[model samples]
Target chain A: MIWQLDIMFLVLVVISAIASVNVKDLLSSAILLGAYSFLMCLLWIEMGAVDVAFTEAAVGAGISTAFFIGFIFQTTRRTKD
Target chain B: MKERYPDVTIETVCRLLIPPIQLFGLYVIAHGHYSPGGGFQGGCILGASFIMMFIAYDIGEVKRRMREKLNTILCATGVLIYAGIGILCLVLGANYLDYGILHQILPAYPAKARALGTFGIEIGVGITVMSVMISIFLNIGTAGEHEGEPE
Candidate 1:
């Protein structure tokens, strides 16, 4: 595994994690979290855990993102705090 | 959400995309024993395809295709298949889920029987995961009042 790519994904993951929490719009937060999941998947692949990466891509990035969007539609899109 | 004007582009794109997504999901499940994917991941892919359909169309559309009762029944059936296989292995004079013993009934070698048994359980897991994902989305999206169209 290239250390550069690993570092890149690691930085991106941290940035997305913080951004998602700090975002005022819940929808944007959800999207950012999906991005975080994708980056984590990349890290997993780089570490040779291909099966975990596959699951992260499918459930973490794909299904959970859709679930979050669906949930956002049923509630307020903006955060109270 | 109120019914909005249907976007032809979105509908067309989703219709084209869903089939391939589902096919890939099945491929993942089928090749899971030798590959990086398995039942949970593949089933999530399959469920995500339907969720995409729900997004492009309406809840009524998905409901028409997969009724709540049918979905729930499918969820149970998957678990039943999983348990039945395990119990069958036990009744075959082996420990629970000991698939090597399956060779006695099937016309295959012990090792082949184990692979076949694992494949069967993967299928069961895939089925259960898919239905549960759909059920969760339906309940969350509609707030559990899925008897009729959202108003």
Candidate 2:
């Protein structure tokens, strides 16, 4: 595993995590969370955990994103806080 | 959902994309023993294809194709298959889920029987995961009331 790619993904993961939590628009937050999942999937692949990476990409990035979007359609887009 | 705004481009793209996506999912499930992918990942891919259909088309369209009763039955069937395999192993004079014992009935070597048994469980898991995912998405999309009204 290249240390540089690992570091890059690590940084991006942190940024996306924080951004997803802090974003006011729930839809954008959901999308950001999906991005976070994908980055984590990348990290898993780099670490040689191919199975986990596959799972993360499928369930974390794909299904959960769709679930969040479906939920958002039923709720308010903007946060109260 | 009641009011339809049909987009030809989206419909065309999804129709073209879904078949290949499903085929890949099946491939993942079938090759899972030797590959990085397995039942859960493959099933999620399959479910995602349906979710894409839901987005591009209408919920009614999806529901019509896969009725709620059929979905529930499929969900149960997968679990039954999984349990049945385990119990079969037990009845074959081995511990639960002991695949090596399957050779007595399968006419294969012990090691090959183990692989076959694992493959069977994976199929069961893939089926369960796919149905559950679709069920969750449908419930969420419809807010727990998926019947009576088209909305």
DockQ (model 2, Cα): 0.91
**Model 1, position B101: C-alpha lDDT score:** 98
lDDT of 1: 0.92
Compute the DockQ of candidate 1. Answer: 0.90
Per-residue lDDT of model 1, residues A1-81, tens digit only: 899999999999999999999998889999999999999999999999999999999999999999998888888646589
Per-residue lDDT for B39-110 in model 2, tens only? 888989999999999999988888877787888999999899899999999999999999999999998999
Error of 1 at B15 (Å): 0.5
When only the first chain is scored, the TM-scores of the models are 0.92, 0.93
Q: Per-residue alpha-carbon lDDT of model 2 for A16-46, expressed as tens digits? A: 9999999988899999999999999999999
> Alpha carbon lDDT of residue B65, candidate 1?
81
When summed lDDT is taken over every stretch of 10 residues in candidate 2 chain B, the lowest stretch is B142-151
